[model samples]
Target: MRITRYIVITLAAATFLTGQGMHRETAERMKDRGLSTLDSYEMLKELTGTIGHRLSGSDGYEKAVLWSQRRLKEAGADSVWTEPVMVPRWVRGPVEKAFARSGGKNHELTVCALGGTVGTEKKGVTGRVIEVRSFDDVRALGESAKGAVLFFNRPFDRTRVNTGEAYGGAVNQRGSGAIEAAKVGAVGVIVRSMTNAMDDEPHTGAMRYDSAVPKIPAAAVSTMDAEMLSALLKKDPGTTVTIQLSAQSHPDVLSSNVIGEIRGSEFPEQIVLVGGHLDSWDKGTGAHDDGSGVAQSIEVIKLMKALGLRPKRTIRVVLFANEENGLKGALAYASRDANVRERHIAAIESDAGGFLPRGFGISADSIKFGKLTQYASLLDVVGAGKITAGGGGADIGPLKPFGTALIGLSPESQRYFDYHHSNHDTIDKVHPRELELGAIAMAILSWAIAQDGL
Candidate 1:
């Protein structure tokens, strides 16, 4: 009886080892296949080149929805569908112009209107620019800021090693500057573009207003222009600037989130999701901001099909809508009924960019993270084995309450900010090999989680 018990225990150990070995081998094959084919890059080129930018409520976004459905079907998704979502419709009208007049000279400045901000009057708004590093600085001046252009000139903290951290440190000025400046009776708001690169290209992003205070036009000036404006202010405090923006916000419109899935062979009810926001800021083609992410999400389905790897849990790909200015698509998906929510065991989002592949960032408890680390060895081949805590995508953030294990694909981020929300974010910036490697990493992780729960 003792010998029989020992044999049973030894066989169980052997089975577990064999299963892990198979996962490792599968990961290697996925890497080789992905690197050789470079399918993700091709898909991205087609999407960006054909669809252009896919800002919510735009014609391009509508075309992208149809394009996504077709591509997912081609990628061998067992089922594909769209979920309805209502999104804000904002238009950056025909013109956006700005210039500074000081020191007896006119300096042309590159600028773009912040999304959802009110437009300037037909003649535009001209005011003596008062540069402030923070909202506190505006309040310190009391009524002095009234009728002036409040310039939020807080630049990205260059000292921070991580560019994302630097962006976070300074981004508040762009998002809330209008409301804060309005409180001080400011006529307009000019914010420094949120990027580390010292370029003349303005970066546009979402901004909001307070119903209590009057709404005002908000725009982002290039980093170089911000520097110039600051110097002009220091030299001559009476320096004035003129800003003209035709941007306008319209009524909400109907949209949808594109979804496709590969059914699990065993645990069909359980699910693992791969996703990225489909809507991008209208400035550029959005190659890096989330175009790469969308391509990578769909590539996971393609890779699994090509390798004939049938996961034990369903693998779904979601291309979220309106992530640029709003999170309506994310909210709509997360608000599904309890039965649908409980089936989601894990979700992975690749919204960072198409940069070189790094490890994933996980947002889960210690027990689940430990279980997840068991598959880290399989990811080493692609150099995505490094895993940290506290990470998820903006689109998948709502799933946290349901206890979904959220994962974010953390690619190298140094260059992402340079192009984010600017015209520089084009497909040419993304490396084909790097993009494919990211997809390979996601595929391997999804498969591992599908085979073994959590």
Candidate 2:
């Protein structure tokens, strides 16, 4: 909680004198390096191209742990380690199919199984289809939904400027639609894709079941398919469909949180942590959702080493596991050892896509947060240098109770959902210059926090 780092840095910043002047000088050097550097871009390509999707408890995820551990050391982190964590494994079996038939016409819907959903028998579950706009509609139907396939066809609010906000408005149906439908004895549940884009690509995300409800099958229908089904339902009230989801859950698997740090020259125990989830959904390589974050976190240390600016506090970067389906990794890291959490001054996470850097979301008290605004403004050269209110990330949420200053790197949100959790979230979607800018933004802020106590 001491912030003499920013206070001292801001005073000598204009004059660029000594002490904190060295911090500014080194940050300027990092800025120049970021502009010309292809490291971030190249690193992301290697991960997405090679490792591909790394879902929690999958073989890909285990490989990602080893890959990240080696890469962290190769990036010149002073020390690297992994903490064991057990994560639930959800596997998508082969051939997921969902199709509707009405008035002798057939509509083959593009669909993928929602994470953590149970699989139907070999032939699949076919029954009368019930279309509902929201959970209220399902409740209204009440017992009428018994033994029927309930489709939650809520569309993202395209009117919202922030697509993330639009996704938030509609995603609850995807996350909780099954639980509600199950209460009404629904045998199957379908949710619309959580994206503003009206496309055939079905987005898959995490969904959980309330222990009291019987586990049932769930799938995400593409936005276009959702609209098609809705229209068809109106045309023929008794339209029916067969959903054959081959997904199943198995025993939990052992996973690891990839962690590394640059030991501080001064307060080595005080830590400023930066990270993103290493595990992604089992779709197209998760370049935007988190491959970008993993590479960017490691890139921060690389940039720091290149600049030769030793921090006053330990700079730790953790590539957490199981963020997509479960928070086991985040919780594990936060509770790993009491002593570690006690020394954690701040934790920053970059999980937003590798879009243009907008600004950072700072979460701290007025006094401590004010220091961040001043120290963080040094990133103004890159558009992502501003400081805003209300920030933290899912992977870092567990650290709040320990008095850790939680921060989230905000990026342009216009197109993030377009590729999120879908096949479009590939490495090709990431722009090199934009990715580097995000890495630079995090590096500058991390340096600021690492320069002293947070």
Candidate 3:
């Protein structure tokens, strides 16, 4: 329920491996408690079902903050509190419509505006649409794209084994499609949704403009709509589209980060943090994008309390705000105290989703990495102990620069992109059992770190 970091080492116990074997004992016991008695399903159900969409600067996010404070106390946290944060506010207007004319016919396309984008005026923008596969294609277009609506139709790379990698490859267009389009005097821009699944659902995410260049309206078209648009353009090169988006950005709004903790009996000052973002895009309930992580992070505290497993170091749970479009919450938490960098040892975040766990991505030097790999054995029975090379989530990403060891929970990624940032990301999409497995793994790791430390 809290976010912070600390590092503690008893040179006598951790000579390259402080309390190594001892940490495993507590870790194995936690795994047992997790598989047999722990349950985070109902909490997740209530979260996604009742709390609904928790977009930053929205009422839902405030309700989530209060719920987290109350739930953490009810779950028997030693202390729970909130830290103030300022977040940007973007309003999606009522009028969002687009139509393409080709072959003497008009076709309507499914679409949504990306976050942080500038909206069109009362009449909106219309121009001859030109399709491009990548930024390279945009560069090739040169002045040809001027005054046209740039349509970025790059699909996710199916060849990449890791779907996350595929998303990374295709995400830049959505992040800055409008900026690039405006560079060529384009009136507007349309990007293809970022998912492997081909469907009519349009996925929306954060986008930004460079003040140096003129700002333009931008939106995402569904994968299926993008395909159709591409085919239509091939048939008739002069096809044009009329795009409208009422979305607009307002001033900064006040928000807070929710934090709760189970005090360490031996060393209350030291901390081991686990967290997830509390905010999501406005389209869906945010079940997978981070609701799963928020539920499980709280469940991590609850599970530890239920088992009465007191670690030597404090276990803190944090629910960060504004991770969808900005790292404001993460940066705020990182700057909350000068000692955060000094007192916090390990920060683990679960933002990937609440699906089945495959392993953890541990970001640290060789000594710490080796120790975690050995401790990962505690997860062998549940099959989530594979430790790979990686760091923490976006909310906890800044902590890495302050000398804090960061870890991220990795889960099955093949299906995650299908529902992410779309209306399809509802409660029913999450499997109860798979969600618990992630918490179980996180709990074991947290307890192990508290028992010894990173």
Candidate 4:
């Protein structure tokens, strides 16, 4: 499973096209065919408005699985089915908010409880708010944070080239802040929404607690609200904030990963995988978070079949479930028997917001990726020419240990944070042309990999 083997295989397979003098014509044909079939607007509408939020273990997740199966089958994919996976179901109950009095005026703030957070007693918990920028600062406060609500006001660094990287740097606070704060006796936690843009929308995401640490209720405050709270706390350290969140977690439930495949005529046993998570957060419609990815993956299969492009390797599209609350769908799919794992050659995931595709983040070696770069000219027409050497989306990360060449589709991240995990991630936020360009980029890559046998 060394990465170099994939490169050798791809180069060997592609030699046939070049030797036969069909490379140029094939490229041109694919370019023409892909542009004709790529339609982002219709796909986004179908996924966001029609399918809506697809949280795993919920009814919406099941419906999305069925929708994917029907669409793939209608697209002339050879096979379509579901793979069972166990997923977590955390329900956001009646979440309400109140704030401490400052000069007799109550400042009402916007907030959403974090996923996997424990609910307060029916009466709720209220405590003085303490703001900290980083985990180190929280540790510095120590006992000072006791009986207080720890507010993480760190903002995404917009100066980074890739917004995803900026999100990665700042996300540890959101994911582990509660657990860290609880160690010293903090009663509750409030994280600044992970976005570069200043807005009132509070983003929600999953948080984890250490086994030994006490689990406390955690929520996210909008970036602007976080600033307001921080400013208030500076002036009046004793300012108390009252939070009432009725959110609760249900027992784990059975769910599934929807899969569809266009079997390769030459090498049905070898596979190239393309996918996106089917699950989304409860807020908004989850349109940009992953609805765009699911549609684009399906569109790849549709375009391939319509163009009469029979790949050398089986191209599979899997819509994973529970990517928001847990990675159950990815884990279950990866845990398949050894024989099934052996056939998988590559897995590409597109969970980034559905914006104009800038390039692909590849996690393979130079040689394998160099061979992949052969399609650079083909993708340039669709504006996905920037291919870097490092990446894989969360849903496909598990496949890497099994020697699968993993990739993440990189889209324009400028506005991704604006809607991610917020109420703004609705169908309207996504541009039709940008979504279509992403679909075309994915289709081109999938087609090239399938034909090249990797």
TM-score, cand. 4 = 0.93
Off by over 4 Å in 2: 1-22, 338-342
Models 1 onward score TM values of: 0.96, 0.94, 0.93, 0.93
Model 1: CA > 4 A from native: 1-17, 338-342
Q: Write the per-residue lDDT of candidate 1 for residues 1-454, one digit (tens) a residue.
A: 9999999989976875787898899999999999999999998999899999988999999999999999899999999999999999999998798888898888888899999988888788989899999879988967998899999998889998778889889998988999999998999989999999998999999898899999989999999999999999899888888889999889999999999999999988898999999999998899998999999999999999998888989999999999989899999999987446348889999988999878899999898887777667788889998888878899999988878899999999899999999999999999999999999999999998898777
Which model scores highest in lDDT?
Answer: 1
lDDT of each: 0.91, 0.88, 0.85, 0.81
Q: Give per-residue CA lDDT, model 3, range 136-201, as digits (tens).
A: 788888988888999998889999877899999999999988888888889999999999999999
lDDT of 4 by residue, 216-319 (tens): 88988888888888888777777878778888888888888998999888888888899998899878889988988988888888777877778888899988
User: What C-alpha lDDT does candidate 2 achieve relative to the native structure?
Assistant: 0.88
| Sequence-dependent TM-score of model 3 | 0.93
- Among the numbered candidates, top TM-score falls to 1
- Residue 199 error for model 2, in Å? 0.8
